[model samples]
Every structure is written in C-alpha cells, then in structure tokens.
Target: MSGTDEASAREALRSGDLTIIGRIRSASNATFLCEATCSDEVVHCVYKPVAGEQPLWDFPDGTLAGRELGAYLVSTALGWNIVPYTIIRDGPAGPGMLQRWVDQPGDSDEVEPEGPDLVDICPPESVPPGYLSVLRAYDHVGNDVILVHADDRRLYRMAVFDVIVNNADRKGGHILTGVDNRVYGVDHGVSLHVQDKLRTVLWGWAGKPIDDETLESVAVLGEQLAGPLADQLREHITADEIEALRWRVGALLREPVMPGPDRHRPIPWPAF
Candidate 1:
C-alpha cells in the first residue's frame, strides 16, 4: 500500500468495526485474522486480545497488546517503519492490539550460515564474496541452509530497530516479506522490557560500524523519546520501561556499532 493508503488504514484500524474472520493457532497467545471496516474502507488486520495472553514470569500479565502498540510507535518515531501500523482498542475478546495485516505473496526462503562455511542448499559459493550471513537454519527436509540477508537493506534497518527496542523474541518467523518486497517485523509483544533481553535473528552486522544515515535516525529517535513519543508511550508501557528504552537507545548511539551476541544465550529458541 502507498503511504497515504497506509495512513488511512491506520485510521481505519483505530476507528473501524473489527470482525474476527479466523483464529491463528499460536502457542503463546490467541491471535485472530480480522477485517476492519470504516466508511466502506475495508482493511485486513491481526488482533491479539489481552485476555488470551499467556502470563510470563519475566513480563507482567496482560501487557503484551500494549507492547505491540508501543513497538509500532517506536518504529514510526524512528522513521524506520519496520513494524506495521498498530493500535490498542477493545476487540471481541476485550482490550487488545490491532495491527494492519501485511499481505505477502508467500514465505521467502530465509538465508542462514552454518559456522565458518555457508550452508550449500543453494551453493553458497555461487553467492558473491563479502555477503554477510545472518543466521543458520535447517530446511523442512532437514537440510542445512545459510541466509545472506545483507543484500536487503530493510533487514539491516530492522536489526538496528531491534537493538533500540530491546526485542526479546525476534524470531525469524516474525520477519515477513511484503508484496512490495519490504521486510516487516512483527510479534513485538515481548519488547520494550526494563532489562536487556534482545534475542533476534538479524545478527549479521555484529561489531560493524553504524552507518551515518542510521546514526542520524537513531539521534532523531533519541530526541523523540524525550518528547511527544515519550508521552504517547507512557500510556502503554511503564515509566521504568520507557526509561529503559531511552537507555537502550542512548547505549546504541554511544556505541554506534553492532554488538556481538550476549554472553548469555543471544539467539532465540527455534530461531526460524
């Protein structure tokens, strides 16, 4: 969708009649594929109700929907547009997060690296030199695969975004390739935590210098975090969480480099 269409879709999600069409069987929470209508404009959306959220010891109960919205706000503020338009409202299952559905043709084969050598599913040797491998994985048939995501700049931008938000559950499955071929990150319910817990599949740029453009975006986001964005985020997340977000952004700005994996477990389980 065009920028204008997306803005209109965001509005429709905020003030539309959301009708559940089907349920997405998720292991963590109840998610619904929905259609939202407003003034004859219909848009597909994903609805996650607060009541369906499974409680976690690390995160407080019933706050997942709010965090989903919080991630969208952060993405918008940074001008990254990594996450889709999302809002918190009352759904059939009560209060929840409603995010505009990204329509992709189908899942793309993700690239993964297996140790020093890239997996040979598609002949990694054929891939040009200097290509950075993002992650390692096994195909449905259990064959090894190595993904080279650096060719797409959107994936890199999303990796930077994950650092800013402290996203703890950035699994490969959460990354969607839209019809427009843009990489979109979803399932951000476990983000914006008060402590450091960034688990992600986009770790190909570890220890690399942050580009000037990305650094500038980070600066703008840092400024917004202290202004109107901060005000809006306080409505969804705790003050401590907001403070932690600010700290994370500041840390990235200061370091201005991609970090290596955490000393503890860095990649999420079932990475894909």
Candidate 2:
C-alpha cells in the first residue's frame, strides 16, 4: 500500500467524522496511522482493511474473515491494543478493516523501517538500563510515566499474561517507549497458543516470585473474564474459547510456571 491509498481511505474515514487528517501512511497489512485533525488528540487515527493476508496461526477453519474478527475481539477484551481499528465497507482495496494507526517514534516524514521489527538494541546484554524500566511501565495501568514505578510486581503480571496467551514475540523492541517514556507493548499477532510457544526475556524474573499487586491484577482480570469480557468474546469466538482464556489466567494466578523441555533454555537463534 502507498500514500495514495492511505489518503483515499483517510478521506472516507473523515467523511464519516472520524477526525483523521494529514498525510496517511500504510504501516502494515491494511492499516494506516495518520495525524489527528483535532488538537489535544494524543492518538493517531488507525484504519484497517476488512480483508487481507492470513496470519501465521491457523484459526477455527483457516478463514481470513474469521481470524481478523477473532483478533479484534480478543485484543479488545484483554485490553491489549493489538489489531488496529476497522471500517467495514468497500474501499480501494475492497472490503476491509480500518483502525487507528499506532504512533511509532521515528522520523514521521521519512520512510519507516520495512524489515522485521527491532526488539532491542543490538546485543541484549548491552541494552541500557532505562529502557528496561520503560518495558515495566508499559504493562501498568497509568499512562503517566512519573506516576508509574517499574517494580517486580508489574513485570510478573505481564509475564503471566504472556504465558497464558502463549505470546511468541515479546522481543524488547515490540515494547514501545512513548513521549512520556511510558512503555506500550504491541505486535501480539501470535498469542493464545495451543502449542508451547512462550518465548520472552521476561523469564529472568521467573524465580523471583509473584507479588501482591500482580495477584490482584490477575484476580481483576479473572472476574472481568466471566462477565463483559466473556460477552465480548462470545460474538466472534467460541464459548470454549472464552473458557480457555479464563482457565489460563486462573492457572497462572494459582501457579507460576509449568515444567518445560530441557532444550527450552536455549533462546531461539537469530533472536529477533
């Protein structure tokens, strides 16, 4: 996709009073992030096409439509900003989803990186200490960086969430440091796994044990799971599916880790 395609899509979105303005750029799939026409808007308008390529994981029947809907539903329910916003209609690319684009920190007018996302500064051991604090803050409740303290409790909670979701790509780069220096995690295309695909650097805190704050957060999520969250997931996903999410969250809250294959110690090669 190109700027022309984004511009046309942005026009359609604004015609509906979506408030997206300025030049639009296609970051990935059918999604575009554009400057907000209104002042005091901290977020960029995100748009996604209704149809696109199938993801790496196989959904219920390997259906593209079903998979897209599933991604949107689960991410919203979990309160994790995964799939971009969607607009259902005919477009230059045919029917698709249009969502608010994720604001990335880079030269806005320049060409953005098209290669695999950089997860951390080269050499994990060499990462600066402040960035680690940024990662811890990203998973917390507050957007105010000063109000948020990077402690053990929040890290354990995020790790449990990653574990239950079977998050395959929690690379350091996937976590974003916003203008406030408060971290925000993105790119969860490979979560809620049926296989053993938990790959993350967060395991370093494994033996450190869970804290009260994380336990309380898990309990809150568990309670939400059976109510509104369950209702939300029921629309696009299976009842069993919602139950599985609840079970995973409960299991993690109850127990920290499961026995793993000895070979799991070695990190994936060419670590992304």
Clashing residue pair totals per candidate (backbone < 3 A): 5, 22
Per-candidate Cα lDDT values, in order, are 0.82, 0.48
Q: Pairing residues by index, what is the TM-score of model 2?
A: 0.59
The superposed Cα distance between candidate 2 and the true structure at residue 68, in angstroms, equals 7.9
Q: In candidate 2, which residue ranges exceed 4 Å CA deviation?
A: 1-31, 34-43, 55-57, 60-99, 102-157, 257-270
lDDT score of model 2? Answer: 0.48
Q: Give all candidate RMSDs, comma-separated.
A: 4.6, 10.3
Residues 42-80 of candidate 1 have per-residue lDDT tens digits of 999999999999999999998999899899999998898
Extract clashing residue pairs from model 1.
111-147, 112-135, 112-146, 112-147, 113-135
Model 1 deviation from the true structure expressed as Cα RMSD, one decimal place: 4.6
> Which candidate tops TM-score?
1
The alpha-carbon lDDT assigned to residue 162 of candidate 2 equals: 68
